[model samples]
Target: MSMDLFSIARSGILAAQSQLGVTSNNIANVNTEGYHRQVAIQGTSTSMRLGNNFYGTGTYVQEVKRIYNDYAARELRIGQTGLSAAEASYTKLSELDQLFSQIGKAVPASLNDFFSGLNSLADLPSDLGIRGSVLNSASQLAQNLNQMQSHLSGQVQQTNDQIESITTRINEISKEMAQINLELMKTPGNDAQLLDKQDALIQELSQYAEVNVIPLENGARSIMLGSSFMLVSGEVAMTMGVTTGDPFPNEPELTYSLGGSELKADPAKLGGQLGALFDFRDNTLMPASHELGQLALGIADAFNEMQSQGFDLNGELGQPIFTDINDPVIAAGRVGAYSGNPGTASLSVNIDDVGALSGSSYELNYTSAGTYELKDMKTGAVTNLTLNGNTLEGANGFSINIDAGAMAAGDRFEIRPTANAAANIGVVMSDPKGIAAAAPKITAGTGNSGSTSVKLVSIDDRSAANFPVTDSELTFTLDTSVNPPTYEVFDVNGASLATGTAAGTPPQISAFGFTFEVDGSSGGSESFTFDLSFAPGDNTNAVAMAKLSDSKIMNNGKSTLGDVFEKTKLDIGSQTKSAQVRAGSAEAIYNQAYARVQSESGVNLDEEAANLMQFQQAYQASARIMTTANTLFDTLFSSVR
Candidate 1:
C-alpha cells in the first residue's frame, strides 16, 4: 500500500511539474509575437484493482496543446491581404495625385501665358520683342510638359523597382517556408516552437502576397499563392522572378518556376502589394501619362499646322514652331514590338489628326498574312484591319507604316501614338523672324458685289502645288442666277480652272487646299480676287492661333487642352479617394479579425499566474503525500524490528 501511495504521489508530482512548466513558459512569452498560449492536458492513469475494488492511480500529462483557431487565422490572413493591397494602392496614388495637383496649377498658368503672348502678338504682328516673348512662353510650356512626363516615367521605374524588391523577398520567404516544412516533417512530435516560427513566417509572407496554407498529415504546411501557384509543397519551393514585360519594357512581368517548369503569372491578378503596383501602373499611371502626351501632341500639332498656313517675317513659307510631328525617332517610339514575336517586323506611327487621338493604347496583332486586329486597351473594342500595301490606317487619329520585315501570324505590337509626344516635344524654331503671324493670301473685292464676302480659312498642303511661282491672283466669281449659286475659279491667265455649284449653307468653295467661306446673305452676283502675296503686317494667322485656346480639338473635338489635364487630375484624385475608403474598410476588418485571433490564442498573465499558484499547491500536496507515505513505511519497519 505504501508503495502504491509513493507511485501515485510520484505521478501526481510529475503531472503538476509539467503544468507548472507550461504555465511558466506561457508567462515568459506573453509579449512574444506569434506565440500561442500553451497548456498541459492531464489524464488519469491506469487503475489498480485489490479485492475487486478499483482505486485511482493519480494523473499524467497527455500533451501540451497550443491555443489556436484555424478559422480565425484564415480570416485574419484575408483581412491582412486586403489591407496591404489597399494601402499600397493608396500610397502610390496619393503621390500621383499630389504631383498632378501641382502640375495642374503650373501647366494651366503656363498655357494661359503662352496663349496671352499669342494674343499680344496678334496686336503687334511685326514686333520682334513680342515674338521673342511669345517664344519664351512657348518654351516655358514645353519645358513644363517635358518635366511632367519625366516625373511620370520616373514613377513607372520606381514601381518596377518596388515589384522586383518585393518579389525577391517573396522568393526568400518561400524558400525559408519550405525549409521550415521540411524541419517539421523530420520532427517527431508537435514541436510548438517550430510551429510558432512557421506561423510567424506565414504572417510575414501575407504582407506581400495573398497566401493559402494547407496542412499536411506529416505536420507540414503546403502554401499556395492566390490559389493557383504553389509556392511551397512538402520540401520544395517555387522560385519567383521579375523581368521586363514583353511589349513595354518599362513595365514588369512576374514569372515562377517549380522543378523544370516555368510559367508566367499576371501581376494584376495576384491580389496583394504586387497586384496593386501593377494595377496602378497599367490602369492609372500609364493612362494618365498617355493623356498628358496626347495633350502635348495636340498643342504642338495644332500650332505647327497654324505656322504652316502663314508666311514668316522673311516672306517665306512658315517653318515648324516645334519639332516635326513625324520625326523618324519620335514616330518609331510610338509603337513597341512584343518580345514573343517570331518575326522581325517593325512599324512607325504617325499622327494624322490630333483631334481624333483616343489617348489610349492599342494592341496590333497579326492574325494571318496581311491581316491584323486592333484592340483598344481602354475600351476593349477590336477592329479588323487589313494591310493596304505597306500601311495600315487606324480609324483613331494615327497611321502605321510598316518599316521593316514581314510579320508572322501570332506576332503582336503595342501602338501608343502619343505616349512619347510630351517627352519629345520641343521648340525647334529659335529665330523670332520665323513666327508666322501673316496670312498667306490677301482677299479683295473685284467687282460690284451685293453682300457677299470671302476670306481664306487656312492653307493646306496643296497650296504649294496650286499657287503660281510668282506673285499672282485668282478670281472667284459667284453667279446667283442659277437655282443653286454657280461659282467659277480662274487662274492668273483668265482661263477657268474649276466651276461648281455652291451647295452647302453659307456657301463655301475649296480649291487647291484653300477653303474660302462665302457669306452671301444679300443674294447677288459677287466676285472676289485672292492675291497670292505675303503680307508681313497681316495678323490673321496670329488671331487664329490665339483662338485655338478655346478650340475643342482633343478627344475627337470634345475636349480642350486644359480640359484634358483637368480630366486626368480628377481621375487620379477620384481613384485616390476610393482607395483611401477601401483602405479604411480593410483596416477595420483586419482589426476585428486580429482581435478574435488574439482572444483565442493570446497569452494572459493573470490566467497564467493563477495556474502557476494552483499547480504549485498541487505540487506541495503531492510532496506531503510522499512524505507521509515515507513516514508510514518507516513506522512499519520499526514496528517489525
Candidate 2:
C-alpha cells in the first residue's frame, strides 16, 4: 500500500505540474497571433489487481491538446484570403484615382491657351512672334499629353512589380508551411510551439490568396488554393512566385490554366486584389488613356487646321494643321514640297493670310527631271503644279493629298526647295469635331427624348466596307442584334439593319459601295465622326468651319474636351465603387468566421486562471498522499526497532 501510495503521489505531482505549465502557456499566448489555447487532458489509471480483489490507481496525464475547431479554422482561413484581396485592390486603385485627378492641371487650359494665342494673332495678324507662340502652345499641349501618358505607364509598371512581389511572397509562405508540416509530424504528437508556428504562417498566407485546410491523422495540416492543393500530404512543396516579369496585363486579360487546361474565369468574375488589378487595367486605365489620346488628337487637328488656314506675320498660309494623330516618328517628318521630283524644290502656298486663303489656289507636281506632280495625301490622288522662282503654281487651286502607302519611312519632302530657302509653306490638317467656328453650344434635340443625339465626330478609312472602321462598334457601326435599333446613318444613305446578336451569325447591310453583315450587339448605342470641313468660298453663312464652332454645336455651350473628360470620369467612378462594395462583403464574412473560430480555439484569461486553481488543488491532494505514505513507512520501521 505504501509503495502504491508513493507512486501515485509522484505521478500526481508530475501531472499537476504539467497541467500548470500548459495553462500558463495558454495565458501567455492569449494575445499572440495565431495562438490556439491548449488543454491538459487527464485520464484515470488502470485498476491494480491482486488475487480476486481490484483497486484503482490515481489519475494520470493523457495528452496536452489544442482546443481548436477545425471547421472554424478552415472558414477563418478562407475569409482571410478574400479580405486580403479586397484591401489590396482598393489601395492600389485609390492611388491611381488620385493620380488621374491631376490631368487638367498638368496640361492647363490646353485648347484655351492655343486659341488665346490665336486671338492674339488675330489682333496682330502680321506678328511672327505671336504666330510662333500659337504653334508652340499647340505642340506643347501634345508634349504635355505625351508626358502624362508616360507617367500613367510608369504606374502600370509599378503595379506589375507589386503583383510579382506578392506572388513570390505567397510562394515563400507555402514552401515554409510545407516544410514546417513535415517537421511537425516527427516532433512527438502536436508540439504546441510547432502548431503555433504553422498557424501563424497560415494566417499570414490569408493576406494574399484564398486557402483551404486539410487535417491529417497526426494533427498535421495541408493546404489548397481554391480546389488545387498548394500543399499536399505534408510534402510536394510548391513555391509561389511573389514576383514575375510582367505582373500587370497590358490589356488586362485573365485566364487560368491547369496543365494546359485553360479555366473559364473572366478576370471580372474574380473577387480578389488580383481581380481588381485586372479590372483597373482592362476597364479603367486602358480605356481612359486611349480617350486621352483621342482628345489630344482632336485638339491638335482642330487648332492646327485653323492656324494653317490663317495668315502669319508674313501673311503666308500656315502649314497644314497639326496631324490628326502623331507618334515619335511624326515629329521627324519635314514639311516639304509635294512634287514627285527627286531634286529639292520650294512651295509658296501660305493659306494663313485670310485674304490669300479667300483666293488661294495651287497644285503640286513630282517628275523625274524636277518637282512637278505630287499625290495629295488626304485623297491619295495626283496633284498638278509648276515651280517658278522658288514659288509653286498649280492647277485645281492647289488641292493635294499624300498617300501613307506611297511613302517610305525615311522618304523626305522639301518645303523651302533650296538648301537655304528663304520661303516656306502653310499647315495642312482636317478637323474631326467640327468645332473651329463655334466655341460652345450644342444644337438642341429636335428628336424625341429616347432618340439618340449622337453626332459624327471622326472616322479613319480603315476599310471600305466596314462602318466606323474600328475594332469596337460605334453608333454608326451596323448592328446585328436580335432586335436591332432603328437609326439613320449618313454614310450608308439611311440604310436600316436587323438581325441576331451572335457575332458572324448575320443578316446584313448592303450600302456604301459594299455589302457587309450585321454581327454582334451591345446594351447601348455607339458613335462615330464624319468630315464636314469649312472652306473660304463655301460661305461663312453656310456650314462653314467658323459656323460649327458656335455654342449650338456643343452640349450646353461647353468645350467638347470638357464633356468627353467628364463622361469618362463618371464611368471610372462606378467601377471603383463596385470594387469597394465587393471587398466589404468579403471582409464581413471573414470577421464572422474569425470570431466563431476564436471562441473555440483562442486563449481565454479567465479560463486559464480557473484551470490553474483546479490543477493546484489536485497537486495539494497528491502531496497529502505522499505525507501519509511517509508516516506509514516511519511507523513500520519503528516496530522493527
Candidate 3:
C-alpha cells in the first residue's frame, strides 16, 4: 500500500513539474515575435481495481501544444502582402510624381520661350539678332528636353537596380526558409523555436511578395507565389531571375524555372515590392516618357514642315532646323527564334505623321509561319500586319522595315516610335541665318498690265489643306475684251486652276494658295507674272508657324502641344493620389487581420501569472503527499520494531 502511494506521488510530482515548465516557458517568450502560447497536455494514469472499487493513480504529462490558429495566420500573411504592395507602389509613384512636377518648369518653359522667340522674329523678320535669339531659344529648349530625358533614364536604371536588390534579398530569405523547413523535418513536432523562425521568415518574405504556404509532411511548408511557382518547397528553394526586354532595361521581367521548364511571370500580378517596381516602370514611367517624346516629335515635325515652306537669307529652301524626332525604339524579346544565314532581324521605324501618332508602344509578334501580328501595348488592340517585302506599313502613323535577315515564328519585338524622341532631339541648325523666317517666295504680279486695275489682295494659307506653294514663278494672263475682264491663272507648274471670268462680291480670283483682285478692265491683251524670290523681309510662313500653338496637332487631333503636357501632369497626380488612397485602405485591412492573429496566438501575461501560481500550489501538494507517505512508512517501521 505504501509503495502504491509513493508511485502515485512520484507521478504527480513529475506531472506538476512539466506544467510549471510549460507555463514558465510561455511567460518567458510572451513578448517574442511569432511565438505561440503553449499548453502542457495531461492525462490520468491507469487505475487499479481493488475489491470492485476503482483506485485513482497520479496524472501524467502528455505533450506541449502550441496555441496557433493556422487560418488566422494565413489571413494575416495575405493581408500583409496587399499592404506591402500598396505601400511600395505609393512610395515609387510619389517619387515619380515629384519628378514629373518639374515638367512645367523645364520643358514647357523652354518651349514657351522658343515660340516666343519665333513670334518676336515674325514681328521683325529681317532682324538678324532676333533670328539668333530664335536659334538660341531652340537650342535651350532642346537642351532642357535632353536633360529631362536623361533624368528619366537614370530613374529607370535606378528602378532596375532596386529590383535586383529586392530579388537578391528574396532569394536569401527563401534559402533560409528552406533550410528551416529541412531542420523542422528532422524533429517534426516539439521544435517550437524552429517553427518560430520559419514563421518569422515567411512573414518577412511576404513583405517583398505575395506568398502562400502549403503544409507538407513532417511539419514542413512550401512557400508559393501567385498560386503557382513554389519559392521554397521542403528542402529546396527556387530563385527568380530578372531580364530586360531591351538593352536599356526600362522594365524588369521576371523568370523562374519549374521542373526544368522556364516561365515568365508578370510582375504586376505578383504583388509586393517586385510587382510595384514593375508597375511603376511599365504603367507610369514608360508612358510618361513616351508622351514627352511625342511632344518633342510634334514640335519638331510642325516647325520643320513650316521651315521647309520658307526660304533662308541665301535664297535656298530651309533645311531641317532640328534633327530627326521620328526615330523608333526597338527591343528584342528574351524568348525568340533566329534562323537563316544572317540569323538576326533588324527593324527600323519612322513616324509618317505626327497628327496620326498613337503615342503608344507596340509589340510585333511573329505569331505563326509567314504571319505577323501587332498589338498596341496601351489598348491591347491587335492588328494583323501585312509584310510588304522587307517593310511593314499601314499601321498607325509609322512604318517598320525589317532591314535584314528573316524573322522566325515566336519572335517578338517591342517598337516604341516616340519614347526616346526627346532624348535624341537636337538643334541641327548651327547658324542663326539658317532659320527660316521668310516665305519661300512672296506673291507678286505685273503692276497694272492692262487697263484693269490689278492688285495682290491677301494670301490665305491658314486652312489646314491650303499650304504655301514653293513656286519660283507663276503667270496670270488677262483678257479685257470681255465685259467682266476675264483672266487666266497658272501655277508654278504652269497648270491652269482658274480661267474665264472672276466672280465675287470683291471681284476676287483664287489660285495657287492665293487670291487675286481685279477692277475696271477693257479689251486688251495683258499678261501678269508672279515671281518667287528670297525676300529678307518676308514673314508669311513665320506668321503661319506661330499660329500652330493653338492648332489641334496632338492626342489624335484633339489637343495641342501645351494640352498634352497639362494632361500628362494631371495623369501623374491622379495616379499618385489613387496609390495613396489604396495604401491607406490596405494598411487598415492588414491591421485588422494581424489583430485577429495576435488574439489567437499571442500570450497573455496575466493568464500566465495565474497559471504559474496554480501550478506552484499543485506541485507543493504533490510534494506534501510524498512527505506524508514517507512519514507513514517511518511510523509503521517504528511500530514493527
Candidate 1: tens digits of C-alpha lDDT, residues 255-312: 9886687788867567889888889998999999999998899889999988877778
Per-residue lDDT over 408-483 for candidate 3, one digit per residue giving the tens place of the 0 to 100 score: 6667777777767778788899877877777644333455444565555544442423233444466777776765
Who is ahead in TM-score, 1 or 3? 1
lDDT of 3: 0.77
RMSD of each: 6.1, 18.5, 9.1
What TM-score quantifies how close candidate 1 is to the native fold?
0.88
The TM-score leader among the candidates is: 1
lDDT of each residue in 1-641, candidate 2, tens digit only: 98899988988998999999999988888888888888888888888999999987877889888777767877887788788777766676666666656663455465556656656644544444654675676566666666666766776777666656655676677678777878877776777777778887877766655566787755578876555434344754654332121212242232333454543334344334555565565445655654454355444444554533332222122344555323223322223433234433322322111111111112233444445664533245565556443434553322223422333222335321111000111223222112232211122223323333322222222354433322322223323233543333543243433222312223443333223333334434533332222232222221233222332322223445444445556655665676689789988999999889888988778888999999999889999999999999999999999
**lDDT value for candidate 1?**
0.85
Pairing residues by index, what is the TM-score of model 3? 0.81
TM-score versus the correct structure, for each prediction: 0.88, 0.60, 0.81
lDDT of all predictions: 0.85, 0.52, 0.77
How far residue 332's Cα lies from its native spot in candidate 3, in Å, is: 12
Instruction: Point out the worst 10-residue segment of candidate 1 by lDDT.
Output: 461-470
Best by lDDT: 1
